[model samples]
Target: MFLECQNINFRYPNGSMDVFHDLSFQMKTPGFHALFGPSGVGKTSLARIIVGDFNDYSGVVRSEGMQNLLYSYNLERLPDWSSVGKHLEKITPPSLRDRKNELIASFDMAETMRLRFSQLSLGQQNRVNLIRYLLQDFHLLIMDESLANVDERTREKIILGIKDMFPDTYFLYISHNVIEVSKFCREILVFRNSLKAPQVITVNGQDHKLGQTVSKDKLEQTMLEIMHAS
Candidate 1:
């Protein structure tokens, strides 16, 4: 098993409502997965618990064959004191420099590399921050709306490129874009509405790999299933 969460139940300190109630799920393999649900359904909270940010919750969140589980979100900011290129070059491992350059081109970020972090647009900033995480060594990465403001076309290319370049790494992508998740993720964990039995449903996605196209019929069916589950 890659990750297992058993009987997870949580609530904020002195808060009125429970965030999760007897939520249980597991990821049996390493690949791209998703956490899908309406807003405020404990998606982010559960991610934090998985990454060890919240230990106050009840349940056993365990992982096997996984180390360096990192979380990256859209709003994370890079330091503006240096140029984007310089910051990336400084932190990137020496052996991964070629891969870093390739990603810069793949993400269409070569032009913005010379600019300071604050000088880039919101979408560009998100891409730069994401690249920073990719340069590191991690077993699994939780991307919480990490590609938020990027254009759809560019986002697709970047996602496909990442899937190709890091075939061994695991990703738990969180996005509200139903079509995107249905087309790309290998598995979709759809959360049910609050107070509902069986808080989650695991649906198989198209799991489109690099240079592969998912049929429209299959894509629509996956989307419909996700929507109906939510």
Candidate 2:
């Protein structure tokens, strides 16, 4: 397993509540995985747990080597707005740094490379945020709804591009789009009831359980319930 957790648990700083409850799962070394749930369900929190930023949690969350690299984008704060390309260059190597222009071209953000991150459209910045991690050669990738700011077209482009362009990099994607998740990932992990706690791999496919293969009506009901609850 590239990443695994056993009986993991966590709560906020206040002595009030727990975020996760005895969650456990193991991940293979490759392919894309999707995590879907309503907002604030600890999707981001789980990503934090995977990469080790969130130590407040109990239980064992473990990964090797590139785990931290996989999660550099779930930032505690936003990237500086001075320059998108420059921010990436600081962390990325000169070799990968040179590809910035080409990536910009591929993502249709060439015009914004020199512009301040604040100056670019939200979609453009989202592309840059994605590219930052995509450039790294990590064994696993843990992410949030980082693509939520972008349009549907760009989102699809990224889903396809990651598969085609970076086959070796493992992707752990999180999104609220159930239909898109079905298409974008080989497996889906559904966070029903709450983001914290043991997530249900509602459908199973590929080497892992994808997630619950709900009917269209049930899926819609799930989504509606999720929206209403959180």
Q: Write the per-residue lDDT of candidate 1 for residues 92-207, one digit (tens) a residue.
A: 99999999999999999999998998999999999999999999999999999999999999999999998999877889999999999999999899998659978999998998
Q: Show the colliding residue pairs in model 2.
A: 9-58, 41-195, 188-210, 202-211, 202-212, 203-210, 203-211, 203-212, 204-209, 204-210
Please report the candidate that would top lDDT against the real structure: 1
- Each prediction's RMSD over C-alphas, in Å, is 0.9, 5.4
lDDT of 1: 0.92
Task: TM-score each candidate.
Answer: 0.98, 0.76
Write model 2 residue lDDT over 78-171, tens digit each, in one string: 3565587677677687777656556666777776767777676666767788787777766777667767677888777667666666666667
